[model samples]
Target: MTYSASMAVQRLFPTDEGHDLLDLTREVVAKELRPKVDAAEAAAALGEEFPTDIFRILGRAGLLSLPHPEEFGGGGQPYEVYLQVVEEIASAWMSVAVGVSVHSLTAFPVTTFGSPAQREALLPGMLSGHQLGAYGLSEPLAGSDVAAMTTRATRDGAGDDGAGDDGATDDPAYRIRGRKAWISHAGHADYYTTFARTSDARGRGISCFIVPGDAPGLSFGAPEKKMGLHCDTVREVIYEDVPVDAARRIGDEGQGMPIALAALDAGRLGIAAAATGLAQSALDVAVAYAKEREQFGRAIASNQGLAFLIADLEAAVLGARAAYLFAARLKDAGRPYGKEAAVAKLLATDAAMRVTTDAIQVLGGAGYTQDFPVERYFREAKVTQIFEGTNQIQRLVISRHALG
Candidate 1:
């Protein structure tokens, strides 16, 4: 598992395609995202509407559609390339990174399993960034245990369930009733890739659906007040006897759980890349500060203690980059990448937490202030470990896969 320094550097530094993506992404961030980060944060803190308009701008830049088909107006980039783009964007602002990651996660099911009609109909707006999409698998009762979801979709063919005698009217052939909690883009997304119970079977009953945000009987609760990623809205989606036609169902019954898990496998890689980028940003800040600030009539960075610390952070960032790149390559090859993805997530997130903390230590009192980006980077790093399945769950996945 020895990593080549040249390859790692190449991946991080870039070539023509990479440079083009990075330049385009940085310009968008500089022109649009960076100036608005504070404004977006303040707005979210005050219970105001998030700037959904920014997503449309990003979509116009091709940032939102990197991994999708070119026929759908996506970038058609490989996972390795896509993750690198994610890292660079995240290094600038964690919330935008989260939005990009969530949208990418939402696109997974549709791209992988949606019917031709569904893909053709749904992806144009979504990939174009006109409509924001969210994944809705989590419930009040099910977070880690997706099988425990209680949202039910009882199939009623026209007359039996209660729609009407005339089945031709397009009433919800099935009524949806349940609440999904911790849904990213809960209130803002135009559509949600949701899951529900279609039967009494444990895992077999689960089914995925394309639930529109404006669907009848669908409403959002207040957004959750969280410590970080404030710009990204997370809340509960209540479906109270909502009508949905059979056509809206994502896949055949019992396919939802696997769809959710596979989407997670892809999403975790995005989180890992973002974590690596965040850590890299923190390290850059620490190193620049250490070199400029003088103590004892000498640059603090010249001191062995500070030098060693910065070096360690650099090493960790490189390692994290390598780990995610390996996982991304596996995914691009259409190979089994679950265990590798879990390892990448665990290592990259842990590295981000450690590196961001040390970055604060490097800056002394300055790092603790709102003026420094490291504090925000530190706060943002925490959720990377918690979401996309907790780091503890990642360990379990790695160990279970190893034993198997």
Candidate 2:
């Protein structure tokens, strides 16, 4: 009935620094995360904001900005390590898990393709916990099929006043007009890495922009009533003639798809790690319940049927962990991991769905109510399969890669 490192079960990836990140991450989860999970979940379900103190505490612990350089107020941890940290936190709370993934997504494109000036100007706030970010790529018309995005970014004449103090001005800055749907942290973020069509027609027409939250004509619609990860906000970001300078743009003019996809690739890996963690948590809850919940004058753990269910969950959780770790290793080594990312996301999320359902089975009627956390885990795990690209879309990505 106790959770130990041995019973908690994470296979160590073979990196010295990675091991350190995992150890520290487990400590952070046990101390900082587990204590606050019930309160956080309660607040989230009430549609209240995540505790700002939690974010600050994570920032102070160097959990928020891992995988970025120390100069920018980050932990300078590698992606492999950062993902492990994400998994640990996610095992405790899915909302915090999604928030960190969104943060990493918001910062990645800038660090990868921003002009040095742009990175120097804006990254400090992003890394310092002073600024939160949302990546706005999915529109009402475009989710997995991003080329269909109708959001337009017209090139205005020269001397455009699109630049802000963040070094995001363009000589021929674009005027963005679009609605990004299901944007995580939409109303709450200080900035959004949005994509819009800058040229004629579909395909290569899209371009990226880093729009500030206070930009004129920028606003968010009402939050979505979601099934899970309710701690993280999701809304539609509206851009009505929002000015965007070329300086705010990351990568080249026709490079939106690649940039978005690459960032999504990394984001998917984080999601997989997170989903695996959720599955693991569900397994833990089921195991604990089976050990203590007596039936027929004996603990349910002694029953053959319940014992086999626990065994199956163990295998599934381990498989999911291995899937995500393999993807993390590839990404850490700077390899092309598009297919691997999709696979990790798909398998891990599916495992979460299966394991959580079985967790409820273990608890019988008790799992069906708010009296136990397993039902909440069941609800929360549902969204991981839907967002970060649907499981169906992940399959498409994998199929396309295999064919190509």
Report the backbone clash tally of model 2: 3
What lDDT does the true structure give each of the candidates?
A: 0.82, 0.82
Predicted candidate 1 versus true structure: per-residue lDDT over 1-404, tens digit per residue: 11111112354433478678877877787778767776677677777467677888888788898988889878888888889888877776777787788899988887898777667777787788788888888888888888888998877666223212212235566778999999888878988888889988877889887777788899999889888788888989999888777666666777888899999999999999889988888888887788888999999999998899898999999899999999998898899999999999999999999999999999999999977777888888898898989999999999999998
Identify the runs in model 2 with alpha carbons over 4 angstroms from their true place.
1-7, 11-20, 160-172
Q: For every model shown, what is its TM-score relative to the native structure?
A: 0.92, 0.93
Cα lDDT tens digits, model 2, 1-404, are: 45432235745655686677677777777788778887777777777565566667777777788877777787777677787788888888888888888888989887787766777877888898767789999989888788989898887767433233455333547789889999988878889999888886456788888888888889889888777777787899999999777777787787888889889998998899889888888888888888899988999999898899899889988888888888888887888888999999999999999999999999999999887788888999998998889999999999999999
Q: Give residue 215's lDDT in candidate 2 (0 to 100).
A: 85
Predictions: Cα RMSD each: 4.8, 2.6
